[model samples]
Target chain A: MVKKLPALVGLAVLLVLPQVLGAEYSWLVLLLNRALIFAIMAIGLNLLTGFAGQISIGHAAFMAVGAFTSYGLGKFVGIPFWGALPIAGLAAGLVGYALGFPALRLSGHYLAIATLGFGVAVPQVLNLWESLTGGWTGVKPAAPYLLGISFREDRPFYYLILIALFIMAGLAVNLIKSRTGRAFIALRDSEVAAQAMGISLTKYKTQAFALSAFYAGIGGSLYAHMINYISPHDFGSGISMELFTIICLGGLASVNGSIVGAIFMSFLPKLTERISLVIQKSGAFEHSHFLQNVFKNFNQVLTGIILILVVLYLPMGLVDLWRKTKNLFTAKGVK
Target chain B: MAILELKGVTVRFGGLVAVNALDLSVEQGSIHGLIGPNGAGKSTVFNVLSRYYDPAEGTATFEGKDLLGAQPHDVINRGIARTFQNVELFKGLSVMDNLMVGQHHNFRYGLLPALLSRILPSVKREEAEKRAKALEVLEFLGIAAYKDAFPAFLPYGIQKRVEFARALVSQPKLILLDEPAAGMNEQETHDLAQLIRIMRDKYKTTVLLVEHDMSLVMSICEHITVMEFGRKIADGTPAEVQNNPAVIKAYLGEEEEAANA
Candidate 1:
């Protein structure tokens, strides 16, 4: 009961967020929705890279596959968003399972390079396959409606994304705590020992890829419907890099860390914009065009520095920092 | 009847022969020991049984099943489990989770069941049963206190015991323990010898271990196989192997050299 308090309070806050900030700060809700979507992807990627010890810098390729699949199913097959979402996930999972074949034979930077190829290849393929993907023009999915309730509104859409994130997160948590999750960690730590214990390397490695992509696909479906627009530009290799950064920043192998990292990443651009606005208002760089140009790209520089610092000082990530702080406070009270 | 039999098993790496036409047979429901000096290919033999190493020539069978034809992971499913000489406990998992992984074959459910485990009664029941079994093994091995602790945090001796607990949780018909007493002190080794016997009795399992600890081996093993330079030097009961001329020469060098000195 005591352990449930924090989660209950968090749920309450998520439920009241849109109502509190819907009319005045509607954009914040939208940004939070995007963060929730990325959180879903981050959780999935963490299972593959963090728990299973498989690297994938091409995760955005799975998202691209999901987005287009969902779009196509809605446009041609006449399936609604809810009906098409699982199918999109399955389609992406199939691609991930195919990618797992290369992963079986590769590891470390070689695997990264293989996945990077997939990431770079996907958008180009989407662009060239004009008949299905609509090429450069992209696709617009219909607003998702369930029963009589329309989720086209930003507030309702935020709730919808939040609900999806909740379910996905629950499922991921269950997986990590089960026998399958133990096999993944076992293989990561010691392949010889894992095999000795009856865990099939081929089975679990591919399963991790397929499951991770399933989450990414669902997140992509949500992303497609939320924005109502997607193209090759939306799921570029850059997005893949961003998703990788989110897992590292959050803390590898931790579900909470993924969510924390996603929230931080989603708001980072806004954070930089606010800082630049304040500096400009203060007239600090009025005569220096060089500094102004630097400020315009400040977020990129900040991201690089933060990543380097996190790698060096807090290798376990922001979740580790939170744990350390909590420990400090508890220790002081006990003393 | 022999629970495990290895006939004409030869393993070579380039010009080097690790196990040279080795023949070994362990009686059913007995504690067997394989001992030799460093690089005597004792571990290589264990690896062969574990299916980690494919022999150049031989037939290795467990209860009449072709062990060599099976995959490494399938060895566990075929009622065999092993511990590593280096103690290959999963560093990322807790002690309990480590034991749970040992029962991987017992879980038998697919990804869908695992995902829906939170809602499904069957999955939940299986998980609980596995957990209870793991805890029982931990208690039996006297490491129940460390069940929640990660492998990295435990002492070397405790980690080794955790490995034993892991192998035992599977309730396998045969267990291959590679240097199970390597890192233990004298007292822990004594306790381990007693534990091994009790475990075999309690679980009705057969154990074939490779060890350098002679006192522990001679005291507990019902039968012994001695190897040198990848060839069997002697095979008998403890007293018989202890007095065998070849076994003595292999351990303490030639009688002529000692007489001259």
Candidate 2:
């Protein structure tokens, strides 16, 4: 009941959003749609870091694979956007599975560096292979198909994206409660220890990658649909770092933490721009060097500050805060 | 017939010799203990037997099957399981989840059924039965009470017991326990000794022990092997090994105590 009450309240908010804030905040809803796709990326990254203990700084590369694969399928094969989505995810998953081979031999920081290499290399492939990906211009959406129902408006696309996010979240919840999920956690906890317990390293490590890539690919696919166009610029190292920030601030190993992390990190830039505008109105400070710098690079500075503060103050992430608060109330006046 | 055999097992790391042509055997349904001084290769031998370390020169035959060049998982799948001296428990996993991972070898579902269970709500899966069996093993181990508790949060004794359960979950033909009684006080050691015997009598698991705990080793082991400088110095029934001169010198160090003492 305790858990359900909060979920019900959240559901109520989702149910009321289209009515209360839908008309005025259509752009806000669109931004949230972007956050949902990245939320999937954050959740996928969690499988690697939280469950497998494999630090991958190249997650955006996998997302890029998803995005580009979707585009490739549409352009060459004339597959509809929805038709290419799962196929694109599967292609990215195969790439993730192949990445797992190196993981069997290397570990810790070395694994991170190797994956970072993979991340750095993926965008270059997309750019150099301009025959398919159209060089820097990238590709735009060619409408969407769903069981013969065509989507031609922002409202249908928004609701469609919201459903995808919910489904992916549900999938994550299911996986975290299963055997492979536990194995991933066990592997992350200690590889030698996990092996002694009969958890095979190659199997679980590959599984983590395949799963993480799957979500990222699907997230990327859905994200391409919503954004209407994508290029190498969107799914670059910076975006990958943002995904990392989401997982780290949410908590490395918790399912719930991924969503919370996504919510906060996603809104941060918009919030910073709002602050920058406020600072702009106060013309008295425009000539000062510090104010000028803040105006120019306020988003990056705010993002860096938020990340450092979250790491310092809540290393366990927002999940721990929720747990602490719940404990406070549950144990109130008891002892 | 001897169920497990090690013929001329030698492990070399560049110039240094970790194990020098060690040879021994543990018969079916017998408790065998391998003991030595701190630097001796008793644990090294165990690692070689479990295929964690490739021997520089040796062939290990278990139940007439070749063990050389076998991967670690292959060794376990071939009915050999082992616990580490340092208690290698999956620290992030709960006591129950750890045991489930141990049962991974026998669970036959491939990636298709595995993913199917995740995607569709209405799909009936063979995955449930595998999870059910894992729970049964935990229930059998009496630490089922710690089912939801992570190994990191458990006490040393409980963690030790969890490792034991993990090793035994596969129902291996031979179980190699490295210092199973290490870091335990009297009561826990006593319980471990009793539990070791119970495991053999109940599960019919052939036992190979590597330990520094003399009292527990002497009590639970039927046959014992002593090693020093990577070679077997002595081997016999515990009664016979107790009086061996080489065993005394290697363990007691120029002292006069019997090997079995």
Candidate 3:
């Protein structure tokens, strides 16, 4: 399952064609674009939590920091998107590294609580800081780096996000398959064993935290460019919850799982609306109040249930499940 | 020359002294044994050497260097590696991957080299070399078929073998094996003895083994240091230790002592 066999090869073609085809179709394409960009965010979080074995509940705070940094840089310094892009990422990464010093002492639920507090505190502070952050007023991001190419519409924004996501994803994939990734996994599994094996726990733990933050920053930079504007609300508690939801649903220790999760969360509301419309026409679902309530409030409950189930039963995540099923069929005597 | 020396070492947790004023030394290029009854501080001394526990009062010197102030990793970097009494294997990782991780401290690739390898095709020759060396170690340990297998899936004996393989990958000057043969059967214990000798002969590894099994210790250890209540009772050749009255009283009862005499 993880062998990367051109799975969903035609997905981009099927998605991008609709945007150029018509007006209403273009709106769906825009949503798909946002989903892809968010997938980068999910991928970064996965690298931190899954591969690196660091628990970061306030990952969205780091994202907000990236977005704000990009906006502040683009507007005040007259820096274009290209200049602020990496700068924003670096800024977030530095903060992440600093945070790692404290966060490393804690693990699992305690670490989560610490980052969760950071997540709550960061946005509120941004909102209160009127002079730098424009308080609750929000900031408008400057245009793309090139003077000739202004990203006015969703399609242009789509291409920029796609490129950014691609770069970040490439970096993440290469990194997690390397020595650092092995160290992270080892530290995650057992600190005593890792130390026994001669791994410097303090050094590697901090590295994982910093690298994960860098990825999150890149995701935020891409997000800022796509949206063209940002407010404290854009990166508040709701954003943190959503990022947490994506990581949990996808699997804690997976890369492609994040992409799968992002796509699912992005398309869910739209799919639910469509399903409701079809069911309303059928008359049975529409006339029954109980069934109608189930369809209406079902998603939030379903997401909650899925998170709980994945934690308890499918802790290895979807990727391992897919691998096992594939192995079942491919086993020597099975054929 | 003494490779590792402990002087006036004492470890106290509140009212209990796990090890008290213990003076000991391990010679260079030799298999040294530390044996004690349960809770006699055999493991406590190992912990102090690995920098896991700060001594209440002691001077630990490794190859003329003070070992007291060094971090656990700095100790490893300074050519001291150790295993745990309860096998601390990275259970989620494959056996080969675990050994490869062990060699992380000795990785030859620079930052630019690491980046360059990723960009280049054909498996980044150096990484492949490291992987090949890891396989070589696996083959040497006779668990190469289990290379891809997770440590959790392996039998206890094979896992112990893999842990030793990982420690050797670093090519450390001294290896502190904390009860390497603790959970092994007689056959596995015999194999472990052979592997220890092989490691000493092939890698020129100086080994300090903490074991409860007197038979394994007597069979493999050229020199033995006996501990009782965290203090060294005797230190000499295995025969010399066997003959010592203090060693006999600490390890065996009066009835067995009388029979042996």
**Best by lDDT, which number?**
1
**Candidate 2 chain A: worst-modelled 10 consecutive residues by lDDT:** A10-19
Better of 1 and 3 by TM-score: 1
Query: Between candidates 1 and 2, which one is better according to TM-score?
Result: 1
Using TM-score as the measure, the top candidate is: 1
Each prediction's total of clashing residue pairs, residues at least 3 apart in sequence or on different chains, is 0, 2, 1
Flag regions of model 2 displaced more than 4 Å.
Answer: A4-8, A145-152, A279-300, A333-335, B116-141, B255-261
lDDT values for all models: 0.90, 0.79, 0.79
Q: Write the per-residue lDDT of candidate 3 for residues A262-309, one digit (tens) a residue.
A: 876787767666766666567777667888877666555655565577
Residues A124-226 of candidate 1 have per-residue lDDT tens digits of 9899988777789987887899889998887889888888888988898889888889899999999999999999999999999999999899888889998
Whose DockQ is higher: candidate 2's or candidate 3's? Answer: 3
Give the winner by DockQ: 1 or 2.
1
Q: What is the TM-score of chain A alone in each candidate?
A: 0.94, 0.91, 0.88
Clashing pairs in 1: none
Worst 10 residues of 1 chain B by lDDT: B252-261
| lDDT of model 1, residue B186 | 96
Docking class of 1: high
Q: What order do candidates take by DockQ, descending? A: 1, 3, 2
Choose 1 or 3, whichever is better by lDDT.
1
Q: Give one digit per residue, the lDDT tens place, for model 1 in B83-198.
A: 99898999999999999999999986789888877788998999899999999999988899999999999899899999999999999999999998997899999999999999
RMSD of each: 2.1, 3.0, 2.9
